[model samples]
Target: MGDSRPVYQRIADDLRQQIDEGVLAVGSRIPSRSELKRTYAASDQTVDRAVRVLKAAGYAEGQFGRGVFVTDRSPVGSLLRTGEAVDSPFAARLLAGSSAAPPLLWEATSTATGAPPRIAERLGIGAGDRVMCTRYEYLADRRPLQLATSWEPLALTEGTEVVFPERGPYARRGVRERFAAIGLPVVKATELVGSRSATSTESQALGCSPGQCVTVIERTHHTADGQVVETSDIVLRADRWRLEYHIAFPG
Candidate 1:
């Protein structure tokens, strides 16, 4: 029976099948666009759309001059059981992989600005409250993998050495550690995970095509007395990353 799906979908499906079956090995270049068009007996636009689908899914990456190729099926970003541990830095905890690759590099920009209403609400502060907002991009081998925006109420850091997260003594430290430095220890964290279409800014920063779907992780950290200490919004390319959680059974 003929496939009921659109031609582009059929082409994408065939390529995806090959990738899943290992017929197209990781790092191996996929057939050129012209070649794929001829083989699929589809028009250039159809073939191009099929390839874009694969690219958006993170199954493939296009090289500027070289042809598109399969991407390694590796976890680009991870969440671990240690995420709630105060002594451990958040960035280090997430990037602690057994892979032989070098450590993930992060570029962050921080500014002392007023929190937006929604973020202020999450942080349990009044709307328009002063907050230190830091944006982060984590890259592996210079390839963008994760983006995050971390917020801390200025009340928690004012007059403290760790006030400016990227410039102060506690620069690059986790929320738990920074708060701990100021005698506010983070004892718990909650995260909400969901999916959404990437905004134009997100698409540009992540190198994903317009309207690509992404994974969203919203996290809130609490102090020992149940006060909200910090909150963050993290975004990752769904096609390029996977989130795994290790749930321990109670004794």
Candidate 2:
């Protein structure tokens, strides 16, 4: 823990490190506020404040009946190619002046409550299943670029209790890499694209106005057996981040 920060901040940072280090596995439940208070020897309000810090930093979320759970996904380091060939017709038009590097603002846990009903069904889990989620705000040359969110099924990550397990569901190596390590290699992915006005939270995260339009990319990942393993949503500031797709002509 860094000495320059406050005790609560240090506490939060330690928890974050544990998550990043796989001490806390994705989708695993965290100790209750009272438990934290007892462990940290702090007041209830202090523990609550620390938890809120974790949430804002994208480490955990509070589920009504299930308690707080760690999110599984992490931020994407590159935007150019996600191990998939670009072949969409609008590929050229989307890539004009789009750069690969984007500054990161925040990457922490996000609640899965806002997902559309259809997406919930596709995961083969009820709307109530604890999901490990991550959110990132991308910036180019210090300006807002894009915002993205990714989610993974908790059931797939059972037994991994670290906030960000080193070898569980969606670790630093990504879902594909983690799955492969566990003998569940991903073979393909299907993506859906669209656009919409920025929600209040999106606006705050992306540093954009509420009415500004944003690009939305929803992807469903599958394994060799065609089992849908995970789903992700990438939202970008329409004016800043542009999508580039490389197409192969079938002559």
Candidate 3:
């Protein structure tokens, strides 16, 4: 049967297969516009459409004054989720067991602000409630790899040493440890994972192409009494990282 698919689509599929088979290795330049036009007997518009499809699907990228090229799809690293994540900084948990690269860096800025509706809901507080919000950018193998924003209700830590997550004597301590010092021992946690196209802000911040796929994690930590302690939203490029989870089953 003839391919009912469009010419541009068939072209994209063939290129994708070549990429998968390593015939077109990462960093290898794809055929130029004129070359593809001649080879496929395709119009300039059809060839352009095929290239756009490759870029959008993350199969290729274009360089200034250069033709499109296959992109490296290997993950930069993985985020390890284990029992220790409750007490470890998010950046520290990334590839801690693997020799990813020396010197992981986490840049963070915390501000006292009112929670947005979505964040408020995750933290189980009213919209616009006061919370200490911290934004983080993590570099793995010295590449901007992940971004996260955390919201902690001020009601639970007002005037306390841990009020500012990135400041004070308890700064940088994980929620379970820091909250335990103040009488809230976190006992439960949950995460909802999903994926969608990266937003413009995310694309610029992470240095990836626009419309790339990203994994979104909505995570919450709860105290023994069932009160939520902290919640966070995390984003990472789908082509550059994998999420690994570890669960301990009590014998």
Candidate 4:
């Protein structure tokens, strides 16, 4: 029973349950520390500890002066699944900081995982091979925007810690810059776009309503030599993002 757990653990568990039950949907503000202390009849330390636990577990996040709030629960794939490839040009233009695009915030993380079957096939490697994975979550004006994960062969990344770099490549030389340093320069990319419903875990991350649709963008990058060096899958929130593409015609 929750009662047997530590008071802080119990409080965290209760909050987690609330989130799972939709009592605290995405963007919902949580009680202040003092309020939580009073409600739980616990000390400030206990309440603070509970909040920290929740945050560490990715259930909640703190906003300066605004207190804590529930995280978005939308899945990352909702934004790219529309059978619409027409927006690729527009998205590319936006990535290029073209005149018509708005500014955005992008965060990236690199990880190492035992290659899953799907990823292995994409990289022409065996399943369970060690692989370096880079995840990117892009936001526009602090809203849930787009999600992407890129995978590379671990052998190719030896001597370079692409994943968990001290300062993310995006923060330094940018994604292209970092890859270039490792001799994996990207020359061209092919994409496949589709849609699907959000998984429970993805729904929690994207802060979307249950059963909401999502977009998925799968991309494979090739070097100038035509070697498939990296593969990325990007998921996005459908409502929060728009896809735009440019059409070119020649006489």
Runs in model 3 lying further than 4 Å from the true structure: 91-100
Best by lDDT: 3
Instruction: Supply candidate 1's per-residue lDDT for 119.
Output: 98
Per-residue lDDT tens digits of candidate 2, residues 1-251?
A: 64787667867887888888999898888788788878888887778778777765556767788888885434323244344432111112223344434333333454434334666676767776666665655454565556656666756654553224233445455566666666668888777878887787886776555555677888777887777667877786654545655556788
- Model 1 C-alpha lDDT per residue in residues 1-251, reported as the tens digit of each score: 97799999998899989999999999999989889988989998999999999877767878889989987755555544345442233343343463424466788888989989999999999999999898988776676777899898999888899888777778877777788888998888988989998888998888776577898989899987889988988888776566766576889
What TM-score, over all chains together, does every model reach? 0.80, 0.53, 0.91, 0.54
User: In what order do the candidates fall by lDDT, top score first?
Assistant: 3, 1, 4, 2
Residue range 89-150, candidate 3, lDDT tens digits: 65334444543465777889999999899888888899999999989987756677789988
lDDT tens digits by residue: candidate 4, 1-251: 44678999999999989988999887898888888888899999999989877765556777888888887543222122222442231143233432223555677676788889998888788999988787776665565466777787777765674544325443334345556777678676677778786666666667654445667777776778877777778776554445554445778
Error of 4 at 189 (Å): 0.2
Q: After TM-score superposition, what is the CA distance of residue 191 in candidate 3 from its true location, in Å?
A: 0.8
Backbone clashes in candidate 1 total: 0
Return the top candidate by TM-score: 3
The residue-level lDDT of candidate 2 at 58 comes to 53
- Candidate 1 TM-score, C-alpha based: 0.80
Candidates in order: C-alpha RMSD to true structure: 3.3, 18.4, 2.4, 11.3
